[model samples]
Target: MTTMNLPIISSCSVDGCSYNHDHDCHAGAITVTDAAGAACGTYVDASDKGGVDASGRVGACHRSDCTHNDHLECTASGVEVGAGADRADCLTFAPA
Candidate 1:
């Protein structure tokens, strides 16, 4: 199997997200996007609920303007997800 060293989702406050459980993220990986604002591209509706036991990691980041973005990858020590204007957002996102 291929190994990937990606940033972790340290915390999440969007209890309505499918990947959020007990204020933590359990998805295998997540994608950060900025289509409308810095947000979690992997977020799903509150009705959906499914994720792994372990915490989620950043698989890809499309917010090129984010300071932690490097070639579409997140370079932050860890990321936080929570409710935002886009529904779910990357709290760690900051402009470069």
Candidate 2:
């Protein structure tokens, strides 16, 4: 099967998130948007850490209004995650 080249998470500023490490994300893949308005659904604010030792990528995006969204996937080269109105949000999101 062909592998999908998902969008990379260039950076993340949500220090409270369990998956955030040194301003970077470590989840294998992250999901953004839905009812949360480009929010990072993968964000978790627990005292304990989670995820692996690799950079995160965008596995799926539910913001159909976002310019980079295509078929529920993110088409951007990369995305930045940070704290916004929500705990975590996609900084690269742009209205379509």
Best by TM-score: 2
lDDT of 1 by residue, 1-96 (tens): 122579999999986888888888988999998776688988887677799989999999999998999988899989988877677899899889
Overall local distance difference test of candidate 1: 0.86
lDDT digits (tens) for residues 1-96 of candidate 2: 112488889999998888888888989899886756588988888878888887889988899999898888888999999867687899899988
* Residue-level lDDT for 43 in candidate 2: 89
In candidate 2, which residue ranges exceed 4 Å CA deviation? Answer: 1-4
Indicate which candidate wins on lDDT: 1
Worst 10 residues of 1 by lDDT: 1-10
Stretches off by above 4 angstroms in model 1 are 1-4
